[model samples]
Target: MLVKELKKNGLQVELKVNIPAKDVTEKLNQSLIKISEDVEIEGFRKGKVPLDIVRQRFGQNALNETLDELVQSSTNEIIRDKKLKLAIKPKIDVKNFGEEKGLEYIMSLEVIPQFKTEDLKKVKLTKFVSEVDEDDYKKTLNTFSKVQQNFEKKDGKKVSVGDGVLLNLKPMYENEIVKEAQIENKMTIVGNKMMIPEIEEKIIGSKAGDKLNFVCKFPSNFPNKNIANKDVKVEIDILEVRVPKENTLDDNLAKSLGAKNLNDLKEKVKKQMQGELDNVSKMLIKKDLIDQLDKIHKISLPQGLVDYEFNNIWAKFNDDKSKGLIDDTDKNKNETVLKKEYKLIAERRVKVGLILAKIGEDNKIEVEESDLKKAIEEEIMRQPDAKDRIIKFYTENSQALASLKAPIFEQKVVDYILANIKIEEKKISKKELLKK
Candidate 1:
């Protein structure tokens, strides 16, 4: 076989490969022998078929199969020999294949780029710190009080617009009503707008033994195909009046929430607030780190890698738009602009990933079995009756488990950098702290 480098441009390489006719004949002969041993003929004994007969029956097919296997194996062998870190699978196109000149093909692929990362110590980053105060504790206490409160049946009273009530409801659309259902004394706040906004408003002033009739028009984008953009009339039956009850935060209440006393509960609330603030600060700091990395790095991304990143970003953008999280004003913009902007993000991510990998390798940073086990246990504790499920999920998805290692690895890297860097604690107003 003869090999020639046809093209080399920006991580992309095209190569021309040619195999001798004798080599093709040898592979075809071997395949024919295998077929002859496997086939069952009427007059000939097993493994006794003549070479001429076997070649006459399946020669072309055998040659095709042999060539396919040879192309796949030889291309991979060539890539390994050349030590090319390919980003995607190589594409092969046969230019000429016959008995005389043998088989010739062209293969194209993208190889990984090489570049040195900037020194980590030279990078400057600030991690914001927000300490929980008395106000934050009081807010947490109020939230806990609401969670501990329960609803009870109220005596005879008129259900006003701002009142809460329990009721049963069944809505029907059009002349033909194929489905009917009932809600069993479900409590609904009258002015909370849980159901149809128009119907909820109409039921606000209803009293016991009073029947309210209202029609709600479903939006065009409603999920129910049959009822979408159509009018649905609902009859609501008021059962009982209900109100939210307030609870006092005492020793008993604190004990119920896994605390020793009111003081302990307050301390816990403060710690929780501090944790949330720390998480927000970390996110802000990470964003700044990426932005700075992108600004400083000057490496050019391969077209293939840029395309891959754009597809992911485009998918996420469309998903957010469908969920009403992104404005429709920017939906029809050019993808090239999006690609160019997001390419920086991709480059930063790639640079960070490579830096972390190098740090881990040079320092011999390893994720122990115990750490992975602890992480899995923490995940299991989050779900009800999900221990087996969590284990099964981790077992089935080695890639996800490997991703968990990245966070552990990155944290170690960051901790190392923070230990060596100069970070001074700064006290600021709550408003300024939150803005960070």
Candidate 2:
């Protein structure tokens, strides 16, 4: 193996790496063996396929894996040896690859800019401060009561609003029973428009055990196109109806919700609301602090990092636009204009990010596992209905976990800066504090 620096222009370093053919063949063989273990042949059982035969069937895939593993391992070794603090991920451009010719590639690296942190004590920032209003606290209490609602089977003859009705459904399309659309034991909230608005409306005022027959017209772009743009005959058998227990704001209700009493519940609600208000205020102050830091430090932003950020922003914008979610102002902008504006935004973001990172390095600030656990726990509290899904998403997706850590680290650094800087808190109304 050989490594040589091809170019060093500003923060960008281009390296040319070459691996000898003998090592390449060794790696290719190892990959073939690993892959062949699961491959089957006509005359052999699974996991007993011959290497040559596996190569004959899956050679290209094994070779591709070999190249990727060799390149990534070599790059990691180089990055570790050089103690490289990367601003953006390295780009690899293959020059040559073959069993006999070995492998060669150019790896372009973008290193983060190193800078000394300036004293932030002189930087003055206005911090917006507010508390949860009485009205808002009451509203939150009402929300909590709604969340704690207990549904009990109704003894009345007819289903009413806010009642959960268990029912079976059958849809007929074009004189054929739509078995795929049939459902049983589906508990739907009356007047909540389950599945279809018309179905819920027709089911209201109906008694349990009553059979309902109706026709529902679906839109052309409905998920199930077989029934889309057409009226389908439907039959429903109501199994049971349950109505929500009244939400009584009292000590017993608070006890049912795990609070000591009504006052404790209010106190907890106020504290939670206040914590949210503080987060909003902190975010506003952090932005202002970052803007000041950006102005104070005139480090030459790495072009590669700026370009990477710009591409990400552009990709997100295009994705949103493709979904018809672009605002009128951006929708009217020409591509050239949008690109120019996004480029500047990207440069600012990259510059600020580099500044925060340098500060963290200088201070040895680190994100602990506990911080991530707490963050995930908070997310579960906010989205209790999607708790399992949220946990699965972060636990399974490495990129998503990294994204979660990025913000946590950023906020920690910001908090450290705030502790040192001068902040003037101005009492503001909740409306002013929360204004977008």
Candidate 3:
């Protein structure tokens, strides 16, 4: 066995490997012996065929099988011996192979780029610090008030903005009633923009027990494909109208929400908001640190890795476009422009990912069992109703578990870097902190 580094580029390598003809013949013989045990000759019993006879009859077949196995094993051996961390599977091309001649092949792969990380102690980062204020508290309380609002039945009263209405709705298209378009006792809030503006406009000022007939043309980009861009006649029967009762942020309201009193509720809200602000602050700081590192340490990115990431991004973009769900970032760009933009993003991501991975490897940072368990528990807690299903999925799917572990490892790496970095806390107003 012999290995030679044929070409070396930044983060990419091509190697030439040669296996001696004696080794190839030895492997062929071993494979032939294994096959002889199962092969049957006309006069010989099963598992009793001689190796020479088996070779005479199945020489080409056995050699092909052995060559396939040898290629993979040899490539793996060379990779291991070279200590190469591949970004993607190596491309193997057999240059020469014969019974008398040695086996030779070329293996090309993109490896993790080699670079030195800047000293964390010398890295400077700005951490925005914000304290929850009265405005935030009041806004949160207002939201809670809306969440906890009560409704009082209105008898024979006309529908108005902010009033909730129950109705029976039937939609007809082309003089035929659409299937699954009939709903009973559906509750809708006026002025909430839940339905199209035209429908809401026609429903307003209608009293209970009134029947309204109207035709509405759905927008071209409406979510329901069946009704989108189509004009449909609608029959609405107003069952009842109810007005929301004035809500007050009092002790009873707080207690109903599992708090002892209003003060307790405010304290809880403050803590939750503060935690959210802290997370935002930490995220900004981490971004700054990564940005700094990306600027200071420059290395050529692997085209294969960039292409892989770009393909993934483009696939998702196309999927979103098919579903009529283009995000703000990609809303108006043409496909060619989008591809160019995303290619840059993919390259940056691959670069940062490689750097962070190297940092984690250098520091011996890893996601421990306890960390994984805690992450799984937190995920289960987030979806308490589907705890059993989530647990079953994580147990049965190793890839899903790795997906959960990746972020944990990345965060651990970030924390390790932050611990050694100099982060300057800059106090800012809550408004400024929340601004994009």
Best by lDDT: 2
Give the clash count for each candidate. Answer: 0, 0, 0
lDDT of 3 by residue, 215-250 (tens): 888677766687788999999999999999877889
Q: Rank the candidates by TM-score, best first.
A: 3, 1, 2
Q: State each model's CA lDDT, in order.
A: 0.75, 0.87, 0.87
Better TM-score candidate (2, 3):
3
Model 3 TM-score is 0.78
TM-score of each: 0.73, 0.65, 0.78
Model 3 stretches astray by more than 4 angstroms: 9-11, 33-61, 165-241, 255-261, 314-341, 383-402
Off by over 4 Å in 1: 6-10, 33-54, 98-102, 152-156, 161-186, 194-239, 251-268, 315-340, 343-430
Off by over 4 Å in 2: 25-66, 97-100, 131-277, 428-436
Report the lDDT tens digits of candidate 1 across residue range 266-286.
888888788887887777776
**Cα error of candidate 2 at position 206, Å:** 20
